[model samples]
Target: MGNNILITGAAGYIGGSVLANFISRTSGPIKAAQISAAVRSEEQAQKLSKLGVNVIQVDLVDETAVKEAVLRNEIDIVVHTASAIDGRIPSHLIKALGQRRKVSGEETYFIHSSITTLFSEEGGWPYGQVRDTDTVFEKEKEIGGPHPVRQTNILVTEQAKAHGVTSFNIVVPHVYGRGSGEWRKLSVSIPAYVRTSMAHKIVYKFDKDGHPPAAHISDLIELYALLVEKILQKERIPSGEEGYYFAMAHRTPWWAAMDRIAQSLHARGLVAESKPSIWPSDKMAADYLGFPVLYVRAMGTSSGDLVPVNAYRLGWKPKWDEEQFLASIDDEVQAVLELDTVKATIFDLLTSADK
Candidate 1:
């Protein structure tokens, strides 16, 4: 039998899409592998069970529940897309993987999904213009602050190494495109902007223009599949501190995107104007968009100068580029109008703690 792989946050956009991508494979190392999904609720579990994978509903914050889910499933590999800010969840899973290795006498792997925004100046990255192949771990350590994502990244790397489990961090940028997942098909940033514009009857933009890295959901999923395929084939690409893979397919021009979004919404009769106005205050944007006030500015502006070399080196070829993304603004608006069903809980923890 192939390895047993478990994916956390199976009801989320990225996790659900990753699960869909894996199961849709007809023939590959992935097809031979048994798949399991770790979700938060019975509703989510039932929804994912239809995909023909083992679905476990467990509280990720509870270490016992997380460890039990890991060990009971014999999960040799974990694709954690649940929480980038919470370090404890990954810590528990990595510790369980260490125990699983001792019992099964086989290798285990942890693939952590992290925020690429952490590399941006607003996100507290001190180093200018970094590549995925650079010493990101050390730099993050050197410039450590109250940034939860950075802390989580450091914890995942160090904890996985200490437990003797192979770990890879996928530095995820602003992900666009509708997801193939069963639930929460809409991504966070664009959908929120579209929804906020519809509610307020106007489009808004940040005062400062920024070009953050971005990827279409399809291209990002392809990168994940490539990494998993390489790992299942026993190809030692990179792991632990050296395993940072920046999944940046293109750069998102924030002002241009908002302008296009404004035009799209105006055409749809959802907004009052075809031009985006500068946000009067970050506080208003945060309040209306339901984003945490602390990170709202970073979310709206702050483009990291990140160059990705790792994923491409591992044979990842993303089909989407800047032109394609810019051309798809209408599609992004349409997706929010149609598929914005699930309330995004990814920021629930962050926002609650902020209060």
Candidate 2:
């Protein structure tokens, strides 16, 4: 029998890319009919439906609704990518999975999405490259966050395991590149910088230099597919917090990234100067751009070197490095300039053509 797959947050950037990649490329025991998308919008639903996907409208907060949806669909593998801040969704889904396992005598799996920001400290900066083996935790309450995604991951993973649900947690770094989905196209940080620069007509610089880690959306999705394939084959996956995988491709210095974007905008006559101007203060930067931009600015203030040793050991390779990522900036910026939509990216168009 084919494995039935259900992805929550089907309308989101990562989720959408995962859905498209999985449905378009998956083979050997996973069929397109076995794939279902739990989306929140009709527009997303219609678009996914056109792609021959099974779309189901889901309310992440509604425990009963989520449970009913899982059992009703007989989801063998549940990938949770939406709202990591909410702790109930994983528990509810695990409960439903337990019930299904009892009736059908089959095992279930849950892939929970997490962010690398959990590794950030208020003033801590690592001078050397850091790997997944370097990570250690104290307590969830001691951890600060814009959102407590890491803490929630720990809680949910524990609950899922306690309920006999095979859980895998994936921690992704600042994701770049275009995503092929119905709703959004461009990933965070870079596009935010581009849009902010377009709005202000110039690109600003930072005082210090820092290179944080990054991952291409396609590479991240590929890792997800590999892990899912292993799970379906009844292969052993590194479980628990220590065994969790960090999804990252390479590291790019903030100033270098700024230069690439500024060059693209300046060459296109979109910005006044390619040379960046130093921001006076965080508050002023936030005022000029937006709160989200501050997070990008923070990249320059600290070192976020995340090395994925586990990915290599598992034989998962990333196709795009910093150079390739930088080389594609012009295309991404040009897509936004020509299309007049933040969702438009050359990568998305290219990937969609492959389908």
Candidate 3:
């Protein structure tokens, strides 16, 4: 099989950053391999094309188009970062990879990005303090709920196994720091909080405090690059049922972070007070933050007791700690002020279904 790789959602936050990481490598298997970026818009295609990678503008929901892109590009691996909830898109991509494997007579791989909140009590995970080495797939299937993330996770594992494609799920935590992508430089949770605070001229915090797992954007990208490097070198690592890699660097103290944000905004004359006010209700917070009401509480307050053993086993070292993340609140605010140009469409399906 050819060493060509395809990255879906190439214009999205995580996907675009992964693309940037792959291309910036000076000497590695990734540098020698052909890279293809699958974007959804002509504008995104044009902008990403300037980086000199093959940018394919194709709707991921279209199965035929997805298969064509994979086969034509001779893509051996697919880094799918499009949607954690939409199983259809990954289904198409995985099936396409299966077809490619048959044609090329070689193995194929799929790396799926998922949410860590699903493992918390608030997110319906009955078992507490789960490790990445645990049987995450079985437990998730046993607790089966209406959560789209969990459902999609099950879909990815099952479908990939059926297609004889090796799969790994990167259980993503609350990611922060400025991204190096061409589009959507800022992450979701913190930037939304900053925007909502500036809009109301006051910072709001949940009545209940949370300490969610988080990682710096750079560290998260490094984890991706490391996994890709391992795959390209044909190094045997965890895959299939035991491939849950938690991308967590530190724990984000929500109340404390909000307090710092309030103080920072107040010092800058952006807010009326230096102390954050308790959110009146989850509904108000959801409406203001533009997050799905059903998952907003979990997003803001659930801290999954996750023990990441897989990524670290692959020699993943994260430089950021809780202290560093707390100290960087000001930088997070500045990133929102400058690079919040791309409107997030990740929650579009959830919001529309709610309506």
Candidate 4:
């Protein structure tokens, strides 16, 4: 227990997976207490405690508390996975939905979680959105301008590194999987579309004309485990920067997949008739109107072509691709609907074994 590692956001998606990975790998007694989880809720603390992970309620933004936690725990490795979900649900939107629900809500236009897209401009033509990519995800993609998640990693990683804790930063792209993900980050749009199709008896809806990109839950966990293994094994890997990484998976045209989904839903008798349309009122057309938007995400999702594991040079590798990744989401979504217990199941799995 000499080389203690502190994992932040242990109750959340990526954090939960990271914990699961650590526990799954190291079977026998080893060097360093090796693992501790930090969270805010007492409930989360108790859950993690059950897993045998020392759980602490500390706010990392409070440099002093973070410093104290690291030192008191004798933590040598810190994996920070804390951040606010970017809620695009405006107050008005929520109110409208609530009112609609109260007033015999005839299931109207489906809702979609808003996303921070990236884009790039090249060959004098601009791509509409940007995302996790080789250089800044998109050439000039719409930047969420360095998210708090990335920032927190910096603080924790720097602190650990400064104290001579061999460190690596694992930046996870939108992650979707079982016992993981919120707001469709790792969700493969196809599965969601299929679900929608089944409910409406339609096969697909074309929010946009392109296939979306994604990262699977297991793949994301595997990447983190790889990073931790690489670090504990004392291997040198990139800390982003010169070797920046973005988690990506198989990309497919959105509408086509939606069509397939609708067809499946019809076969299942979940939906009635299908209407092929885009999710958003208008798809990428409006986004392309803005120069900044065009430069960021438009092309990243549509035309982005690169290996996500290149970020592995920075010490991260996900042994997953598009086809398997999409299938996993379908499984997760179906399980959640059928069992109606995604959150609880996630907690049990994460806390059952200490990492």
Look at candidate 1 and tell me the lDDT of residue 134: 92
Clashes of each: 0, 0, 0, 53
Worst 10 residues of 2 by lDDT: 344-353
Give the TM-score (vs. native) of candidate 3. 0.98
- Give all candidates' CA lDDT scores: 0.91, 0.71, 0.91, 0.44
**Best-to-worst ranking by TM-score:** 3, 1, 2, 4
**Model 4: per-residue lDDT, tens digit, 242-348?**
23344554554455445445444545556665435443422332222111232223422343333455444545555677666545544544653553322222222
Q: List the residue pairs that clash in candidate 2.
A: none
RMSD of each: 1.0, 6.3, 0.9, 14.0
- Model 3: pairs clashing at backbone N, Cα or C within 3 Å: none
Q: List the candidate 4 regions with Cα displacement exceeding 4 Å.
A: 27-33, 61-63, 84-167, 180-206, 260-270, 274-276, 280-303, 309-319, 326-329, 338-355
Query: How accurate locally is residue 311 in candidate 4, as Cα lDDT from 0 to 100?
Result: 47
> Model 1 TM-score?
0.98
Using all chains and alpha carbons, the TM-scores for the candidates as numbered come to: 0.98, 0.85, 0.98, 0.61
Q: Give the per-residue lDDT digits (tens) of candidate 1, residues 57-78.
A: 9988999988888888899999
What are the per-residue Cα lDDT tens digits for candidate 3 across 104-203?
9998999999999998999998999999999999999899888999999999999999998989999999999888889868889999999999999999
Per-residue lDDT of 1-355 in model 2, one digit per residue for the tens?
A: 2378888877777888898888887556444338889887677788778878878887766888887888888888888877565677777877777777776678888888876665554223333445666543334334434344555776766777687777777877778877876667666667767887888898876788766667889999888888777877777867654556778778766787788889999998989998778877765565554433434355445555566777667778999898987788887687566433534231232233333
- Residue pairs with backbone overlap in model 1: none
